[model samples]
Target: MKKEYKIGLSIIGLLLLVFTFTDMNISNAVYNPESKFGLIFEAIGEFPSAIIATFCTVSLMLTREKDKSIKYNLGTVGYIVLLIFFSLMASMIPVKYLHGPKALIPILMAIYITVSYVIAKKCATTHKEELRRAAIVGILTFIFVIIAFNSIKFLWGRERYRHMIEVGSFAGHSMWFIPQGFASGNEFMSFPSGHSANAAIMAWITLIPTFVTSLKDKKSWFIRFAILWTLLVPVSRIVVGAHFASDVTMGVTITLVIFTLLKNKYINNLEEKDAIHMFI
Candidate 1:
């Protein structure tokens, strides 16, 4: 592993450890509706993920050969435009009138994945290696992260922030404490956050091309954008009453760990010409 990667993971691990001990206090700090900032973050956190997926998928299609860059770039731009239009339209619908942001976003993500998969598969006729590897990483990242999060959630059986007696619930426990036999029968499944997991996966998805391009050519804007999205979504979930601080902290950490491991494996498998790990 690279020095930076190791250091990054270590920092995330430390934060996870610290948050595990202070989950309740942290949750309480942002739990108040009066905070007001969380509403803004929640409203925009998931904004451009599908557009990003489109960009990544399109970039994979425009491999070394095949002079289709113009068309693909235009297509990606069009996708972004449509995404912006839909987002504005969706915002017009009141939050109370909608079913669930969590559920709806995943459904949209699934659609984006399906579209990207089809495009990549079609373009694989010429750009086999790039498209295949990108798609494989993406599919695996999605499956592994979601499964890992839900598995822990099912086994941990922790309650959400508002559900705990700190806010208002008939039967509740301390959010900071983890106890034995805490593995089942809790209706709230809030130990680790699924929305935060989504944020991590989105970051990883966008990161694939960035890693494949050039380690030395790392784009600062893209890195900042990815980091901002990853930070905002999970925090929004915690503030909006869906998860506790520790839940999102652990969720993001687990997703990054899995994503980094998988990305490293893929980098290792590629030929020397495409070996990103060598430089890192």
Candidate 2:
């Protein structure tokens, strides 16, 4: 069993390394908002992600956690991944690279799967109860995110993109048109990359619920993949050129902050008395 586990992890690691070195559509970033944003985010995500991870880890430490060896490792790994991803997303560095989309996204999936699995399995709880709780929490949080995001969408209407890049000033210069995220045609939306927002909201929604269950089981792996499914929609938006590098940035920043806060402040205590009811 131990040998197989080691071998499996080794194989996964090797695959990630291979993908890391593989060429990217690095040139694709020239006008592609998605690729451009992906590059920038891949560069910058780590700083904030690491801060988020450290906060969570510190939470555990402050409480004097015992029997938490695995969760600690999982959070530590998540921290490391954010750091590494930040480096990899830099397209401006100008290294010639060629990579298959298949290769890149799978490595991302691996990270999600790993985090979800460690959290689900290593944390103590009844499997059925834990799954149910995670499901409920995930569902509720996701709904709220979508509603809130859309409401923000409606509330901000045509002016939101201004907040995104401050386009009205020349100052109005804070914008990207190739991705077409501006309210130009729509005139009611702009500011955040809705495509990126959905993707990030999905990621947060997916990750938090697992905290209700700890994301450490084989079944949880499937759930993690489901969350990844959310990424595809955003990638599609970028390909269509409706979002810009800055828009995606703002969108993700919004998602990460909201989701992480909700997860730690509330979802972390799902097993505690009547917390799930709070979702009501």
Candidate 3:
């Protein structure tokens, strides 16, 4: 893994550990009709981007096309194997069921694997471009996630999930523009779902293009499968009640904007200037 990505993951893991402890401390903070913010935070963990980003940053370490392709293939295959294992574990962990799994996630997993295999087969050269595409993508994803987590905490301050207590205002103000929680005396921010943002970021930005970029054609069998896998990540989050559709929209919007900017401004221009890694 690149130094930056390692740092990012380490930080996130540490932060999550902290939150788990804090959550334990505040376990009694739950309320009946949840403030939208509370619900958003709870579900934000299911975002596709969040999962993909975690993988992509590490994969970015590959400098040679061969290495990159190998890592991509390996990571993807590993995920499917793990998913299958978890599928069997469903009896022990309800989350393993994948809210709307009904053959959808499984089918997409198959597609992801098949298309990814085809793309790996298509690479004619093993050139290592000097451009920092991998690192750039990684950094952008890392920054987006950091922002998402912070925003969730700040916005969902009224979260009383564990403690079962809901008290506060959206902006900690009474003004209408201040936007109170979903209801009276409510406190929480629910408009944008962090989970959706997390999942959409990877699906829309990295996973989708990562698959299609190497494909011969979008309409080809490979592309079709790649697209399905990409879309499935975000949809899975919603199916699990981790985020509202609107939250996904916002996440998609952000992911698209950032992706387009990065793809055009940097990734497309990734010629070997022989510069150092870009994610510092």
Candidate 4:
């Protein structure tokens, strides 16, 4: 593992530890469902997943030309399925919850996906092998992070602060460590914030340095941006009473761990001659 990733994980661990104790208190102080900043982020906080899914879809699509064998064809089908599933999952919340004309949601999604495809195609064309490898790591990270966090959310079945407020009862409130199991609806999937997990997946941008040699020097900037986005989105979730601090912390931790492990195994451990840059 890279020293930086180790440091990053350490910091996340410390935050999770602290939040475990202060989660409810922090949420109590910051809970403001009507805050303009919180509302704006509520609609857009999951946008990173759309960008990640689009790039992965583009990269995998470009790979279809390398072989026409049955195995490759099957893989192509799987890739397309994943792309559609993930894209829809990423866009559903924002589109459904947006306060404006519903028609604009599809238009904005089309534009973003189109732009992502173009950029991903250009990058993959220039650095074919590197980008393809990055795409695999990214796709695996996204899949695992989404599945793991959502599964935990369902199994934990903790109610959101906002939901508790609406019910006018703290009876349903549970700590992050408690698992009520089988949440009946969206209101109960609150132990781990899916928004925060999706936000943390933006960390995939940091891996661009491994493929885009020209931007290798700017890797730290990308990492900083990813970290900032990950933290900010969770803060928004907390401000809006959608999640406690522990929920967001655990959500971010899950993504960072999965991404770090996959990246280390697939990208960092590559033979020196296989690429021009190593993802440190």
Error of 2 at 181 (Å): 15
What does candidate 2's lDDT look like per residue over 1-280, in tens digits? 3575477456645643542333122113433444654554433332222222322332232233346588877766764564344333322122212333544544654554445445545432444344434443343444455456566555444333223333533223222222323244443454455545545644433444444544334556655753564454444443434443444445555565566555555546654546657776
Best by lDDT: 4
Which stretch of 10 consecutive residues in model 4 shows the poorest summed lDDT?
271-280
Model 1 poorest ten-residue lDDT run: 88-97
Clashes of each: 0, 20, 25, 0
Which candidate comes out best when scored by TM-score?
A: 4
Model 2 misplaced regions, further than 4 Å? 1-29, 32-128, 155-188, 204-236, 270-280
How well does model 2 score by local distance difference test? 0.43
In terms of TM-score, which candidate is stronger, 1 or 2? 1
The local distance difference test score of each candidate is 0.62, 0.43, 0.42, 0.82
The TM-score, computed over Cα atoms with residue i paired to residue i, of candidate 4 is: 0.88
TM-score of each: 0.64, 0.37, 0.41, 0.88
Clashing pairs in 4: none
Better of 1 and 3 by lDDT: 1
Per-model RMSD to reference: 8.5, 18.5, 13.0, 3.2
Off by over 4 Å in 3: 1-51, 64-125, 130-135, 156-189, 204-214, 218-243, 269-280
Task: Indicate the TM-score of model 1.
Answer: 0.64
In angstroms, the error of model 1 at 197 is 0.8
